[model samples]
Target: MKLVLEILTGVLFVVEVGEGCTVAGLKDAIAAQEELPRDRIIFVLEGDPGRTIRRGEDGVPIVELGFRHGSHVYLFLEPEEDNGDDP
Candidate 1:
């Protein structure tokens, strides 16, 4: 299945993975493709918290997590924290 990953900074990535791809696996793939650390790339499903996608769902398959083939995910890039708090 293919999914759209739209980074918070306006970068976009269309990734193709197996039906059993877990959230962690997807993040790793993106990290490898973008040459960034997996920990820095985060995916979040907006709206209600109950229905939102969280990092705790790492081991769950995206398909079973209600992610469609063309699901649009918001990828938040969390850079390392510094002495100064800046976005």
Candidate 2:
């Protein structure tokens, strides 16, 4: 399926994955396409209110979660931790 990832910054990315792709795999695709950290990626599934897909649900396949071709999802990238280097 072809999914559209809209990051918090308004940057958009299109990821192509197999039908068997799981949430974890989807995150991996997003990270690879945008050079982001998979661990920090969260998903707000379209039409699923109050449900934020996270790492714990990685085992679940996206197809089973009501996703289809051209499915749009909001990608929330967890803010990076501020190290001591910050002034």
Candidate 3:
């Protein structure tokens, strides 16, 4: 199965994985392909807040999240928190 992912930076890429593949596996693949840090990436279903897939839920298979071949998903960077010390 091929999953199309659109990053926050407006970059789009396709990952070839099986339906049985876990979200964690996908994340690892994305990180390797983009040469990014896994901790900095987040995955969410396009236009669906309720379907946000967190790193903790990586064990869940892609099909379990309602994703099929050629599905399009959104990738965003984990937002950085603003500390009060920032002036």
Candidate 4:
């Protein structure tokens, strides 16, 4: 399955993998493909900040979560404003 992950005001990356690709794995995949640093990447799932979402009470890694086939995950580049314009 190919996961379509898009970041607001940034880039949209696609990941092709077998079944059972976790969110955390997806994150690593994106970083690898985009040549981005893991420390500065964040994913937003279901409209909530990925950092705030819990995998098992603790904050979850973007790679460890489950994604539906053809599902799209939204990622936000850290250190960049959600809105491009300065406040």
TM-score top scorer: 2
For model 1, what is the error of residue 79's alpha carbon versus the real structure, in angstroms, after optimal superposition?
4.2
lDDT of 4 by residue, 1-87 (tens): 777877786577787866655555655677788787655666555533333332342244334554556767776666743675766
Off by over 4 Å in 1: 46-52, 79-87
Better of 1 and 3 by lDDT: 3
lDDT of 4 at 18: 61
lDDT of 2 by residue, 1-87 (tens): 899878878888789999999999998888888898999998987774645787688999998887789988889978788888978
**C-alpha TM-score for every candidate:** 0.75, 0.83, 0.81, 0.57
Candidate 4: worst 10 consecutive residues by lDDT? 49-58
In the range 1-87, model 3's lDDT, one tens digit per residue, is: 998999878899998987689988888899899887777677778544447887688788888888888888988878776777977
Ranking by TM-score: 2, 3, 1, 4
All candidates' lDDT scores?
0.76, 0.85, 0.82, 0.60
Please identify model 2 stretches exceeding 4 Å from their true place.
48-50, 81-87
lDDT of 1 by residue, 1-87 (tens): 988887777888888889889988988888888786787666765435524455577898877777778888788767676877677
lDDT head-to-head 2 vs 3, winner: 2
Which structure is stronger by TM-score: 1 or 4? 1
Error of 2 at 72 (Å): 0.7
Worst 10 residues of 3 by lDDT: 46-55
Clashes of each: 0, 0, 0, 7
RMSD, each candidate, Å? 3.9, 2.2, 2.7, 6.7
lDDT of candidate 2 at residue 8, scale 0 to 100: 77
